[model samples]
Target chain A: MTSSGGLRGYFVRSENARGFSLLAPTLILLVLMMVIPIIMLVARSFWTQSGMIETADFSLVNYQMFFEKKIYLYVLGKSLLISGSVTFATLILAYPAAYFVAFRVKKNKLIWLILITVPFWTSYLLRVFAWKLMLGYNGVVNSGLIGIGIIDEPLGFLLHNVNAVVLTLAHAWAAFAILPIYVSLEKIDKSLLEAAADLGEGPIRSFLRVTLPLSMPGVIAASLLVFIPTVGDYVTPKLVGGSSGIMIGNLVTNMFGRGNNWPMGSAIAVMMMISITLVVCIYLWLISQVKKRSN
Target chain B: MTTVAIDIRGVSKVYNPGSNQAVQALDTVSLTINDNEFFTLLGPSGCGKTTLLRLIAGFEQVTGGEIMLFDEEIENLEPSQRPVNTVFQHYALFPHMTVAQNVAFGLERLKKPQAEIDATVERVLSLVKMKELGDRRPNQLSGGQQQRVALARALAPSPKVLLLDEPLSALDLKLRQNMREELKQLQRETGITFVFVTHDQEEALAMSDRIAVMSNGEVQQIGAPTDIYEHPVNRFVADFIGDTNFLDGEITSVNDDLVTCRVGSESLFEAANSGNHSVGDQVTLFLRPEKITLSAAGDASRQGRVANIVYLGNQAAYTVDMGDGIELTAQARPREDGNLPFATNDTISVDYSARALRVLAK
Candidate 1:
């Protein structure tokens, strides 16, 4: 009987092993689709460009070129600045709206959340195109301003500029910012607010100390959601950014699409990924420091 | 010497506007809590005891009347503005904060100097005997420990009135008993006006100097715990406060505070005080379980069959199956002779003095 029991235990362990093995296909697929490509991109960054197949020789020449060329450096700096601005603006706008949705608008919460997410249901490219029309020289915005006599003529700053790209990205990612913030605010126990009030905190103080700090996780998540995608987006800049409005993403796209420099493009892509990872790590570390000091 | 800490005059709360199903949570409730007194609101569920506590805390608005705190009209004041702190039923400690941080939250809000806040937090934590666990987060602590932290947090503010809403209900039985003693000690040490809300009669009796027994959104009776337990004003209060053997009878004779009642064909009972009773009026006499004495020998006033005997540690409780649809319980103290006084299936007589029985108004 003991031997049979041991055999049954062995069978159970084997069943678990079989279950894990069944999951191997999906795991392998994910690695192939995501991890392997990223690894390849990083590896390719070290290779020098050749006629057809890149040179087998590896060097830091591509990275040096990224720094040596003022255009690439400018593009990288502009990309960081633009994405940072978008992130801060999105958070500023989203936090209050999310607080309102979570605390004030109690009923039909799901419906409101769905309404926020409705923009994502339509094609992202279509949304960009719609923004393009709205910001065009003769579009609704320019016409409205001119109609109201705010300006003598249509301003060239609205379309095919950095402002247009930033505006489009902000509109596109507002939903991302709102949802996580709403969820975090919703998870806060109402009694905490009451406790704050009972502890002699006015409405403003309670909001600053309790509500804002507790919702940090959501803010971090929203920041990452906007920053990560905005850093790598070539489409928005390509359509809306004119001559001087080019970013690192557009540079990388040019290397692949027009310049036919795959190795160079992969190098730029790897750098962008590294920069984003470093920024996110620094943000997370800073937040942890703040949390530690507060405690 | 006798400043009223809280004066609630004719307060009521009706929730939900422009709806047919609006509930009158509190109705015309008036109460005066003396300074430094441990007052308890004791009631069953949905009795608006917590609502009353909240109204005093300034967490809820009084629909009609006014609440005064230390001669100040505080019904319109915010919760923060009132010199009151509440220990919530769930002990709602900030989960992200450590015990020390939770305790310091109120002081921080007061914007006291750093040194003062630190000293106060440490003092309160030590008061709750939770100084060692101050560094631990709320989730890391046990339920009893969390309760202490909550108490420390509320007390750290040095509020005049401390409101506890079923604070001990979450603890285990043994822990609850121990915490009750600790809480009483703390209250005595602090000498703050404590307004505790609880549905547990034993807790109310053990803790409070005075208890207000509430039901159906109204205060049925409010008095010292002994009076509330022994001389409950009505049937609901009597039934709610303790275990009582109710004898239904008609008052055959009445004179001032004395009333003679006939229980059945032969048995006659005399209650010392029948409040607002007339001759030939039907009333219920509430005799506590411990008040009745069981004897095997026949008594003139009462007789019954011993239906069951429960052997509790120090005392034996006998359930007498009095025929004519009446049942009574009597307790017998353990004796050195080691002889069982009563047994099941044995006929016995249950007797109590006239003073032991309270005639409750319906």
Candidate 2:
């Protein structure tokens, strides 16, 4: 029975072929939902507007508009700065909390993680609106401050500003930052920490040398999860942000909704995607370089 | 220059306070390790051997009792503050570090000079025979190489005591055997007191200067390998250390030096230097398998039939069924002539001297 190697090999190949055929439908659906739209967006970026159909007059006019317009440049720069700040702040704040959750809190871990994720279950619009109310001129924050007698008057700079956008975005995306970092921290073997301790590292030294370096993957993941989405978010900026808080996402929305320029919107969307992709690639490359050097 | 390296007294640990289901991991364990001796805690799983090691390492606190290292009270010290290092079961080499960096990590933490740290790392790496592989990451090395790197890292700081928690359990059988000798040599060369924990009896017997056989959160016996093998305190220790043939019987006659026990119908057995026992007392006689010899012709002493024959490479082991239905094993070296002296279903005489059996009081 074991002598039929040729037949067995053919059977295995056919079985793998059957498996691939079974996966064809999901692959087709993914291509339709994700790949097709990306290709269409890139194609639309090179075209001129012609009512409902795109004209064949391909030019660098959209690219020139993006670089030449000072408003677009300012918004793009602000968006990058805000997203970068949020990423750094989230990483710094989330790391210790994640380390505690992973190594210190040995009991009720799932319960605590669920509690961390509870804010995300509520409607995003409602949460943003609540932030708006809290940051308003006569909102609860200003009222509480005045009641406490710390600030004599309501600070009008609290709402409709870049600070509000950053604060609200940080609050909104905290769970995103915490979960990945917590997972990465959790995946570190306890024996590794014990080994570090055995090697004469105090708790602080162990954290800096072992825990911090090992959790860089999670930090990068959390950074991308927050920064990539926040760079293109318009809701928080529109609600809590005044004229000074306009971001690249707001411009992209305006070009698509009120500006009635789908080609320009697609061009801006492509640019944003390219910039974020480039930044993420550079970050990953730098991290890999550091890892290589350490090893 | 032999000084007391570690002095542990009345150490016990209980997890989950105020609960009836609490687990007593360690129970008032006390032992003093000499400065340069290799002491091993040998026991089965859940026997509190690892717990005792961890308590001495200051990774776990004792509920009651004290531990002294280098004649100083260190029971309350954190693991980092203790003058000890541990080689974990998995080696736990920092995946982010090269072999040289991992070895130098402890020295760097001690704030040693760069020249000294480099020299010590190189010396220790060379001691472990891993100097050439310093640039390789832990994942790039084999299991034995990684284990050596871990040992180098642990010893680079010149800790007072090196605690090993089943460091060889993860290696393959051949590598484990090879590393065992390397570990012993390393300990001897470094002159650091080593407290090793292992469940493998062979490993414990081979490496330890003194083996503490533990069971049920308590030390059953602590002695040299030969003493532990020849004289076990209880049935658990006797059975755990090696294979032993036990015969349950009643002591018919007892004296200061010897005891005559009635093993079966019409069979009288003499045990030499048997422990304190009274007449008509129920007792058990323990005999090692290799001590008994099998002869084809019935001897006047003990008689049985060959029930089974197992031909090992260097020796032949036979299970003889006595007339009373008790099966006993007798081992003999295979002769070079290949002449078979014993066969299945053949009547055989199982003979052993009075000194071969150890009489244990019930």
Candidate 3:
């Protein structure tokens, strides 16, 4: 009885046991909602689909086909290039807006931050469609320019290409890039700028040496936040990406829906996730290396 | 002849510190600090001592007057353009940079060669005695160590003038005392004109070759530590610098620099005077507590019963209640055998030299 009670007490009274109990509900929900699906997806990746029937035997046939096809690799590389551009474009656009909120807007900072997030309030699909209206062949930009007599004809380059995908994704994920950078900039000591000036640095040089480097953490976070999600975004690419902007996500969707290849889709999906994870790890390592030398 | 390091001529600043609509923070304040001298702007918070310092440092523009650094106009120059650096109140060391990096920042900004920059950084770091911790970031070091790095960083460029804004206020009492001597020694060793701003009168007295006591956006008095402590020109300076007994009185008679005052019928009489004040002019007599000696009531100028006795280590303070609503505080060292001179409720004589008291125009 003592031994049994001792074992029960360990489960009930230990720090680890108490902590686990606190997170028990969240853990259970996460396993049910996320972990089980991911495990099933991995399992399906090793299966073979044969004409309206999926054979559940373990096989690498889908993987072998993915490697055999060069289109998948090309699309994946294009997706990476597009996502990288999106991250860069969003960062450059967001940095100044975030700086204005963090430094210039002494009053009503909350209003400024909320205004940044206002564009993202609508449904994601609608926002992508809105970008469609703005950048379409007979879009607002092209039509407005034509009406102003600035151009002779509608610019076909305005829509349905890699540029359209990049512009739309960058605009969609702008708030994520801005808020973190704003927080980092706001956390910097204002007196450091004054000290920098006192130490004989011009306004521009002071900002480059002190303000830019100090706000790197937020910059890195913003980059990853924009890059990771936009890499696999299919809706924006499908609506605007005609040929050149097609990404890995579109390929996976095709295999699952029209192509009738669930195993191939799973395999492609798993590979995309692995690729994003690998890129993020490398980016973080490079950022750390740069930071180490800054000191 | 000594050269003037900073010639602040009628430099008035009108600034709104966000709390109020607009405060004339510095009012036509003029001062001349000599080269290589440690000058202090001593005042309580919001008294415009810091405003003057900031104006001199080129952080703010003067509304009315010009400031000359080494006899060259600098009010229009940017804070960066001025050849001066500040040791900020909070140090403001870059949180990301290591100690060595922070020290090298100023040198590197001047476009000095890499070897010269490295050597200067090394020398200043060791001068502040933070040689081994140069690799540690500001956040990793203790407050005192960060203070040394801030000092080293400000000193690295060897600016003509170094403005220190209460850089020792954040440290504990013991550490603060140690830093005070070290900072003074640094000023001597570097021979740089040090402009120190602080509210602590003792720190100013101990460190500054000359102190400018400020009040209500004006320079109340500017003199050496001894002159400021001993012969304050106005009531504000006398009251703000130390503990003193202020007795409102009318000037009864004037004799050169000595004026006799009538306080509550019994004119307890002549005190040192400043400026021109005719007889019957309203004035105040201030006597330092330490200047007064306590003894048992005898044939004396005035007598009061001791109302309270506060036992301080090595000394005691006696609150004496004289007639006509007048009370006086006198501090006395304990008797040679380690006992107080008198207990509470005992009548005592308040004895002070006429030279030890001063009269200020009300």
The model with the greatest TM-score is: 3
| Every model's DockQ | 0.69, 0.73, 0.81
Q: Least lDDT summed over 10 consecutive residues: which range in candidate 2 chain B?
A: B293-302
Looking at model 1, the pairs that clash are none
Docking class of 3: high
The B-chain TM-score of model 1 reads 0.95
Model 3 CA lDDT for position B352: 89
Alpha carbon deviation, residue A33, candidate 2 (Å): 3.3
User: Candidate 2 residues A1-295, lDDT tens each?
Assistant: 6669976676677977778678889989989999999998888888776566657567777888889988777888889898998787777777777877898897899998999889899988889999988989899999999999989889999998899988889889998999999999998888899988877788889989998888888988999999999999999899998889888999999988988778888899999898888888998899888877765
C-alpha lDDT of candidate 3 relative to the true structure = 0.91
Error of model 1, residue A122, in angstroms: 0.9
Q: Write out the backbone clash pairs for model 2.
A: none
Q: CAPRI verdict on model 2?
A: medium
lDDT over C-alpha atoms for residue A180 of model 1: 93
Q: What TM-score do all the candidates reach, one by one? A: 0.94, 0.94, 0.94
Q: Write the per-residue lDDT of candidate 3 for residues B1-362, one digit (tens) a residue.
A: 99999998998888765556777888888889999999999999999988788887878888898899998998679998898999999999998788899999889867778999989999999999999998998989999999999999999999999999999999999999999999999999999999999999989998999999998888889999999988888888887788889899898888877888888877457887675878889888889999998888899878899998889988988889988778888898888899888988898888988888787777
Candidate closer to the true structure by lDDT (higher is better), 1 or 3: 3
Fnat of all models, as shown: 0.70, 0.81, 0.93
For this target, which candidate reaches the highest lDDT against the unseen true structure? 3
TM-score of 2: 0.94
Chain A only: list TM-scores of all candidates: 0.91, 0.89, 0.95
lDDT per residue as tens, model 2, B1-362: 67888888988898786699799988898888899999999999999999998888878888999998888999678898888999988898999889999999888877778999999999999999998999998999988999899999999899989999999999999999998998899989999999999999999999999999999899889999998999988888899998899988988988788899898876778898656688888888899998887776754577788888889877888888887758898887766787557788988788888898898765
Give each model's whole-structure lDDT.
Answer: 0.88, 0.88, 0.91
